[model samples]
Target: MIAATADAAEPDSARQRELVRLVRQDCGSCHGMTLKGGLGLPLTAEALRDKPFDGLVATVVYGRPGTAMPPWKTMISENEAEWIVRQLMQGFPEEAR
Candidate 1:
């Protein structure tokens, strides 16, 4: 089980790049192409600088059920989702926008 879990995880570098790409492409539609916030709150450094990883993951996986945000489980894998959360906590990469 442990090995299976490990195997299922994305490599750090790949996950980081994938997260950057996804946020730049998909998330931009709502979060803004710059992630400076749009219909949703800014995903900027000041906004997410102190947010916890788990909270971010929950938001990504389940979304704000009643809001415009939609759960992303169908579009993104669990590992990838977590990677995105990591990216959010770390702030967007320059190339992401």
Candidate 2:
């Protein structure tokens, strides 16, 4: 039942594309180029199916301390993080060629 903050507006198309590239390149490094699993756990929709949605967003923003995950708050907004989680849960989009 968790939702993105009221102020967290959906990113514009250009930003969405930028976000897609960021996840595909940066996150993909640890989550695997396919997001199937690597140093980090799989990010496939099935893998994240039962996880708390808000937590996922928080992880993207705050990161898991003591782990390889690093906070991306400096790079992306919370709303953008939410968008990424939604994409991951529904099968992440491929980086635009």
Candidate 3:
């Protein structure tokens, strides 16, 4: 399980790179090639920055049943999803905006 790092201590450049990779590889598949959000909600910092970590983890693992989002419990470990959520909250590449 990949754990979410505390970005408050991470270098901006490193966070930017990681966020790009995650958006392109992990989130892009469902959130659209640009992560402008499709079946899933937009991954903007304004949408997630103030959200609780646990809530984000739960959504990724269990998904919103009535929504197009699918549960990812079998595909990704909880911690990995948490890490992705953390990255989403930080912001992604300019293309993702």
Give the count of colliding residue pairs in each prediction: 0, 0, 0
Q: What is the lDDT of every predicted structure here?
A: 0.74, 0.89, 0.67
User: Across residues 5-94, which tens digit of lDDT does each residue of candidate 2 receive?
Assistant: 678688989999998888888898999878999999999999999999999999999999999999888888888898899999999999
12-64 per-residue lDDT for model 3 (tens digits)? 56655655675576777777666667766767778777789888878888888
Residue runs of model 2 more than 4 Å from their true location after superposition: 1-6
List the candidate 1 regions with Cα displacement exceeding 4 Å.
1-8, 11-18
Predicted candidate 1: what Cα RMSD to the true structure? 3.8
**Predicted structure with the largest lDDT when compared to the true one:** 2
lDDT for predicted candidate 1 compared with the true structure: 0.74
For model 1, how does the per-residue alpha-carbon lDDT over 1-97 read when each residue is reduced to its tens digit? Answer: 0112355566477657776777876888888978988888888868888788788877887789889988887767667777676766777675633
Instruction: Give the TM-score of each candidate.
Output: 0.76, 0.90, 0.62
* Residue 59 alpha-carbon offset, candidate 1, angstroms: 0.8
Residue 27 displacement (Å), model 2: 0.4
- Candidate 3 residues lying further than 4 Å off, grouped into runs, are 1-26, 93-97
How are the candidates ranked when ordered by TM-score, highest leading? 2, 1, 3
Decoy 3 TM-score against native: 0.62
